[model samples]
Target: MRIGQPGRPLDARKDELILQAGRELLLRGGPLALTMEAVARASGVSKATLYRRWPHREALLEALVLREAQPLLSMLEGTPTDDAGLAAKLEAFLDSMLALMGQPGYRAYLQAIVALPQQQADLQRIWWLGPHQTMESVAALLRRYAAAQGRRWPAAARDAETLIGMAIGLEQARILYRQRPWRADARLRRRLIRAVVASFLGRRSAGIAVCEGNVGRG
Candidate 1:
């Protein structure tokens, strides 16, 4: 039995403290800054206690990210049985992603995952569950909406992927390029989100760039 095993439940207070420290450190200096030793000092928890919770910095970072990611995943739950309802779900999906991408730390987290050693596959796989699961939900929602409209969308899965990619490109433009990030303004974001929702529902919006059929599919 380990220190925080089933026989010995872990302390919630300590977990919160550690994760808070981890978030602060990661955001302040990116993934390279979030060392267990640094977390121990910032969190006021001993190194031994920290290690007992997470074996390494990667594990600690994973815990910190997943905690925040849960809310995003939860936004897709429940039945959206109508066009309005489905649009709401898709809007929620985009909104949740916007919230996540708004965090500078998230981009840092993405960099860290990309830099992981090829042998360290587990970290990348675990961290990706958020986006992957959300994609699954988006695909499911698209399928349901299409079926209700008496049509077959064989490309629902592909379209869902495209939507997610576009959202990422929208937010990550500042990082990938020197252009403006999502926080540029509220109006721009709303316009982009509305365009995305409109496109996915097959109703074109005014003058907004819509993702055409397999145009950027790679």
Candidate 2:
């Protein structure tokens, strides 16, 4: 019974091995396949070693998903360049998110998390909140961009949610259900990003129009 104590330094290499093994197991056999014994055997680490780091399978999976999502999540907090226009910033954000969700392995991990039983509420919450937080960060960026432009896009944050939902929803569906090779083509990706940005701007314009009409009639 090796208890994980505070200030206990974990071996980076060992941690990587364990996580990698966990991912492989997850991809091969879904969440059900991820057991402490299985991960230990796969990673060549003893079961005690695995337990010391992650007490249960859910803990291991949550950590693995967070580790993978952290890089993209960091980008959500990135400062846009002074000269980068809203469209450019939006394009960059969409590109990063698409790339992250487009990876087959990452998609599999997400699907596994989604498939978890409702009884595992904690794990499910952790899995869902990571992506939800990313979405909120994007909304914040949109609001910031609108402010920078000296324009009040009241719906900027809502539109941001729409943009993220559209991109991720489409890509995830295609990746999970469509039985076809989805190669990344730069041109197509750019087109998609442009369309999403245009949609957001268009929706903002419509919102402004409705507001103006309301004021005129008042």
Candidate 3:
């Protein structure tokens, strides 16, 4: 990890070690304890290595959020071959995200990031403007599905943003009240997607329509 070390070999486990160490530190003592030195000691990686990977504490923490969110992003990728498939993927993505936010690790990470102190202007800027990959991914998934159905959801992005916002807000409230973690209501949320589409298109059955449910009951 020395600077100017010619032909230095990279450790394959470096990123994993650093990120895992960062998570442990954050989980153990929140943001205050997640210093570069702490992560280096915990992971047995050099501070230099940590900086090389992420220029500052904010960058490292942001990477951690993105890493944790990978599964939600994965769930929504690619075109679903049919209406039912599309509806299922979208629902699963929504379900997984809400469920994830209720988990201890991911919830704590979000809590730390979302409520970062006012002094952390840089990190706040990065987060507020967003990588928002999951939200963006959901929007993209909706558009593709609409295309497949030979229709347009004019408000897909706006609705997708609202849906994501609500899921996070619900989990934030749960976190605030110290409620036991919970999962998304799979059938109900899928039905919600159908309802959203129908509202915009003005039919009980329209785009990705039943959301492919009859817009159906479970």
Compare the candidates by lDDT and give the number of the best one: 2
| Number of the top-ranking candidate, with TM-score as the measure | 2
lDDT of 1 by residue, 11-96 (tens): 77778778888888866665667788899999899999999889988778778767767787677666566767877777777876
Where model 2 places Cα greater than 4 Å from the true spot, the runs are 1-10, 81-85, 106-115, 146-157, 181-183, 202-218
At residue 186, give the lDDT of candidate 1.
59
Better of 1 and 3 by lDDT: 1
Q: What are the per-residue Cα lDDT tens digits for candidate 3 across 16-80?
A: 77888887987666676778889999988988888888899888877766776778788888887
Residue lDDT tens for model 2, 1-218: 12244555556667878998987887766677788889999988888878888888778978876776677666666445443455677777777777766666766766766777778764554647577767777778766765665655566557767887765555666777745424255577778778877776676667777876777475
Clashing pairs in 2: none
Q: What's the CA error at residue 81 for candidate 1, in Å?
A: 1.3
Give the lowest summed-lDDT range of ten residues in model 1. Answer: 203-212
TM-score of 2: 0.72
**What is the C-alpha local distance difference test score of candidate 3?**
0.67
Model 1 alpha-carbon drift over 4 Å, by segment: 1-10, 28-32, 55-59, 106-123, 143-154, 182-184, 203-218
Candidate 3 worst ten-residue window by lDDT: 196-205
Assess every candidate by TM-score: 0.70, 0.72, 0.69
